[model samples]
Target: MSDILKGLEPERVFRYFEEICAIPHGSGNEKAISDYCVAFAKSHNLWFRQDEANNVIIRKPASEGYEDAPIVMLQGHMDMVCEKNSDVDFDFEKEGLKLRIVDDMIYASGTTLGGDDGIAVAYALAILEDDHLAHPELEVVITTDEEVGMDGARALDVSDLKAKYLLNLDNEEEGQILTSCAGGMKSRAAIPTRHVEWEGVSAVIRISGLKGGHSGAEIHCGRANANRLLGRVLMNLNKELNVGVREVNGGMKDNAIPREAEAKIVLDPEDIQRAMEIKNEFVAAIADEFAVSDPDIRIELNVECNENRQHTIIHPADMERALFVFIQSINGIQTMSMELPGLVESSLNLGIVRTEEDNVNFAWAIRSSKKSLKYLMSDQLQYLAEFVGGTYWYEGEYPHWSFKSDSKLREVVASSYRDLFGKEARIEAIHAGLECGLISEKMPDLDIVAIGPDIHDIHTPGEHLSIPSVERSYRLICDVLSRLKA
Candidate 1:
């Protein structure tokens, strides 16, 4: 066990958390961790099932006096988003996360901490091993590839399970009970390109230091997207200077806002100083515009003197088409819910832009609670792409987990929180996507409520888990379980 978690309250949770951190379990690469879970269940002499897709279900009988209680299911995913700083050399497929603690929070060195859903797995494992805790028969379902999509939940066979009350341990905030989440789908737009062998002085413009975050949770914050900023700058520069694009690349995941982007362009040597001035002006304007939301936005222009160079540049008209498609498409919170104050009903994120050998691709994620609105937004995106001489498609669509008016699970959890903390827990629906939406579809009769300890800045290298929040949330879960009745 790592000493970073030593002497922490609820030692088992932290122990398991540290142990899981030692195994590389990025999305779609969960075999090692899945087998570790199987070994855990085997060592405990519990019944378990491991599916081909690496989803695991472990069953344990109820503790004394709770035999007649309704069976309870605890669900969390086994995968996490693997992100790192540009200078970091960590590999998610080969190396375990390097754990560290600062200010009572656990973080991974130069990489994402994987605390989003890893904490959930640790909680479930700790609860299952505790012999004295009062609860019904427990069914722990740990799904895989949740960050990429709800593929594991979609493929899992849950018919054999008898649990009807499920507690999803995926929410990031300790005091917020997420009862519903937005439905989402990934869209890809590819614009074909032709190149010509002609070059002048070439320079690369980079945009960085934007406070990128989860595209779903932070889309409404008005954070700057590096990809969008680069596109706008390129278009704006085209109006003043003669420039040809060689490459445009930014972002990695469709669910994360682009934090940094770069574009390589060929320009006349005489326009170098003017281009630098234009870049500085644009940067100043952007910093002022996003001062409140993304105060640390940085736009850097790196120019190298390549004299009489001959390199491939995208055809001028095709480059204009690509830039137009990026600048015109809808990105960020499109509409807010009228019924719920401060709730985002529909949104889009231009999450990634890449320049391939023969084409430039733009990736986006469209989300909405309403199915029609989700498709409508997608249709609009497709129209924008095709209007600019490109083609688009959608994939990995997951449905929304709509809020239920009457929920025994919610009432019990809220009352438990009030009893423990002498205060009310916030109950609301989040705009982010959760696997609960897909799992609820398989088991329509399941009573579900999502809860978790506090994890901040998920899906980014800045992710961290609060130690005190984990202790309080663990106590709350134990209190809720002790109060459960048939």
Candidate 2:
């Protein structure tokens, strides 16, 4: 184990956590981590299964006196989001995260700490290997590609799972238990375009320093999407003068709000001066509007070719279609839940935009607590994209992990929490998508709740995990397991 987390409480759990951090386990690249888990099971002499999709299931019979109790499932994904600072030179595909510590928190040097679910994997592995624990039959599941989408959970086979109760260790807060979460999907819209040679002036317009975050978790924060902001700047500029797009590109993932976006455009030489004035006006207006949400927002325009120059740009009609999608696509918190106060009911994010040789493709992440609402938002996008002669498709559709009227597992967990902390744990619903949504769709009878240690800023470079919180949460999970009865 690395010295950064040396001598931490629940030493076994951190040991596994440090071991896995030594391997690159980003989403869609989980084979190494999956195989690592397999090797762990082999060394421990535990029964396990490794699927083609890199999902792992390790089964352990209950302890001597608890064999008659109902089976309990511990679940979390194996993959982490690969996010780093632009200046960080680390290679996610080939390098292990550089672990560091300050005060009670653990962080990876200039990269995401992967604590969102990696700690869950460590917790499950620790329990699985502890033969002295007084627990019911255990089924520990580690899934893959959960950050981009719940692909691993969607493809997971639960027919053989005997667990009637599942404990999902994917929640971020220590004292909060998530009983329900929103359903979501990722979509792509491709607007066909053709290039043409033209003689004109061009400049690259950039929007940066916007505070981007997980689309589902932070959409209600009112931070502006960089892609949408760029679109607005271009749309207003185009109306004043003839403009043709050389290309537009922004954002990295469909599920992350864009932090930076840029576009190259060709326009009349005489319009360049007017465009600068318009750009300044927009900067001041937008800075004031989003001052509270994104305090550091910036816009920069760099002249690449100011003189009449030969250039290849999108056809006028095709450029119009691309711009139409940028402006017309639905985004942000669309509705607030009447049932749950202060919760977003439905929303979407125009998370990514890319202009290529044949098409200008736009990607989105749509989320909603209600299935109908989620579908309604997605359907609107599909039609709008098609309205402009573009093609649309989608993937990673997940169902809502709806709150149950009464849950024995909830009672057990609540009782355990009160016993340990002398206070009630917060039980709430979230706007974000958790793998519980996919698992519940497969095992409707399973009583499930998500719990985790203190992890902050998940899916981002500044992400960190609380070391002390991990020990406490691990004890709570263990206590909960000891109380489970047939």
Candidate 3:
């Protein structure tokens, strides 16, 4: 347990958060964490179910005289996006996050601080453990594999849940209530590769310093993806200096904007100077192009050449196709919502590119609030990949949670927030994917509203949760629960 959270108000929330951080609950690796939740439920004498997908639903009866009140469901995913700096050697499957508190903000040393949804689990646990809090019958649903996709939510049997009002504690902002979210799918393409031996100079071109962030939330910000930028550099070098690529690798998760990418290439010794010149020009052009969105963007080259050294290079035709996939792939917001000014309606992020042993893989995270638009984007990607000598497929498809014209759950949450803070809370739709969409499909009559404390840089190493906001939000949720009626 981290003593950093000692003496924090709403003590159990922080304590449970630290406890969760001590477990490696990354996406696709939540069995241990799921058992932990079951154990917690058993110790408290609560009814619980652990499904095959590792989703856990614990039932807590209403307190004192609140049994007849409407059943209010608290929902959040148990899995967290596992991302870390390149130099960090932490394993997402086994090792726990090295948590630290600085100036009341909690973060991991060199890895993502899974505060995005972990805090939600912590909040639910704290509320469930407390014997004095007033609330309706509670169905605390802790889901799994939400970062990669809403796998748990998709596989969950919500038929057992009788809760009509659901409070999703998964939003990032403290004062904003998100009632709707964009649908999303992960698209992947595999390009064929043929290796050949060639003697020449070998050098690495790296693009770094881009302010990468969440693909869905920050895609409209014009951040330069390191994978895309590297593609541009390789294309320019091939055109200007006739370079041959050995391998290209960058980006971690499909949901995160790549901050850095590296391409290893082989070229004639004579073209080294020309490649350097083109690299500088491209870097300058990119910096100028994304000056507002990625001011700190940088490009570097590290060279090691030997006249007699032979290196393996991907076949020229295959290399061109791979480069085209990286360069021509559409990224960022594709369309804006006309009805809601300043809202993104459709977008895609070319989030990951890697050179495999026999092929190069490219992946994009596509999102749209409209189902048709989402399918259209996926179709475009499929065509692009098949147009070349590659194959494309989609996975983790989740539905869009459209904004409701009238939601009593939203009304209750907003009114409760205003009553507590003396100010109106913002109601809006988010571009990111949430489990609420799938859950709504399972239980169409469920009225859902999402809220959470302040968390910044989610899905990245800079991710941190605000301690003060957590405490404040804890109080707000308790107040909201007290205010709910049948």
Candidate 4:
């Protein structure tokens, strides 16, 4: 509890947010949260339904005069990505997200704030409880497991929903209506590893302090991918020095940019000093290369001479192949939309890389608005992985929501926003994945547009919510509902 949030408007919404923050609702672990939602609905005596996947939909009848209006659906995911600072000891599945308010922004203490979709849930709850706000019949869909995949939303039986127009409360920006989003798939490459004896001195080369971000949303922002950068260093070292790698690890999640990477390698004792010098030179080059973006990049090496104690190391040939493939993997935005300037049409993220007991696994995410392009990029990644003597597996493949220029609900929302703010609202497409794609697949005629208050650093531990933006967005949504009913 902070002084800043204590005085915010719509105390009920903030109160609910605080309560949710105190609940452990990580993806795939939403039973407690789902039960809470069911209890809330029961206490209100509202009609509700819960699917087998734990998705909950509660119906609130429109105010007296608005019952005849078209039904509107308010949607947001209940589950959140469980991310934390490397040094944080909190367990996401059991520990509540510790929240703090600073300078009007609400953030978690070393863990994700869950504002990505939690604020949406709170806002919906507030609206459901408020009898004063004017609105048409409302259906609030609180879905589960949206972070790992749209499991809940995808599993939901859309036949139960009567809403023809849906407002998704999952967008990160205020005043911007997200009408479409890219389709995405997570691909993994696994290469078998056979460890060999460590015949020389060992040292760990660590890279840290690189600015990592959302692989999809921030891919075009030119932020350096630490995994790719570390691979480059390894490739260069293998060429310049006689070294054997014991293990290489970086990043934990597939969606987040890797902030740190460490490589354990065995090098000739005589080459330790030379290796240190090379590490410094490489760091300097990277700092200069990403000066405009990752200014805080750091690279360091620790030296220790030890006999060949390990049972094995990755074969030299396999290590070279893995490093080369990783370096050659093109990441970030590969194509820009011709119809919309600066919008990413297709992109790839070299997300996670790690060495297991017997194999090395690399993860990637590819997103595109065009279905053909999505598969094209995925095929390319598969080919690249095969070429490197690795196998590729895909998961969480979701379709893109194609933009519709003549959406009636879009027009209604736009007019309402203009009437309230006396200015035009921006309608745009996002590169991030949304459940709207799968929902639309089930309900073809459903008109969907996503909106939300301003939130930053989503899916990361640095996530925060803007209080003022939440107030404004709340008012806008209420006004939009009023106009739709009228």
lDDT score, candidate 1, position 13: 94
**What TM-score would each prediction reach against the true structure?**
0.98, 0.95, 0.98, 0.96
For model 1, what is the alpha-carbon lDDT of residue 152? Answer: 90
Report lDDT per candidate: 0.90, 0.89, 0.90, 0.85
lDDT of 3 by residue, 1-486 (tens): 567677888899989998999999999999999999999999999999999999999999999889899899999999998888877899889898998888979899888999989999999999999999999999999999998879999999988899989999999999999989999999999999999887788888888887788998788788889998888888888776667789999998899999889998888888777888888888789878999988988799889665547899998889998988887788889999998888899999988998999999998999999999999999988888999979999999999997788898899889989998999999999999899999998898888999999999888898999999999899989998998856
Q: Where in model 3 is the C-alpha error above 4 Å? A: 305-307
Angstrom error of the Cα, residue 23, model 3: value is: 0.4
TM-score of 1: 0.98
* Lowest lDDT 10-residue stretch of candidate 4: 303-312
As for model 3, its CA RMSD to the true structure in angstroms is 1.1
After superposing candidate 2 on the true structure, give the runs of residues whose Cα lies further than 4 Å from its correct spot. Answer: 267-269, 305-308
Worst 10 residues of 2 by lDDT: 1-10
Give the Cα-based TM-score of candidate 3 against the true structure.
0.98
Please say which candidate is ahead in TM-score: 1 or 2.
Answer: 1
- lDDT for predicted candidate 4 compared with the true structure: 0.85
Error of 1 at 144 (Å): 1.1
- Give the better candidate number (1 or 4) by lDDT: 1
lDDT measured at residue 367 in model 3 versus the true structure, 0 to 100? 96
Candidate 4 Cα misplacement greater than 4 A, ranges: 1-4, 304-311
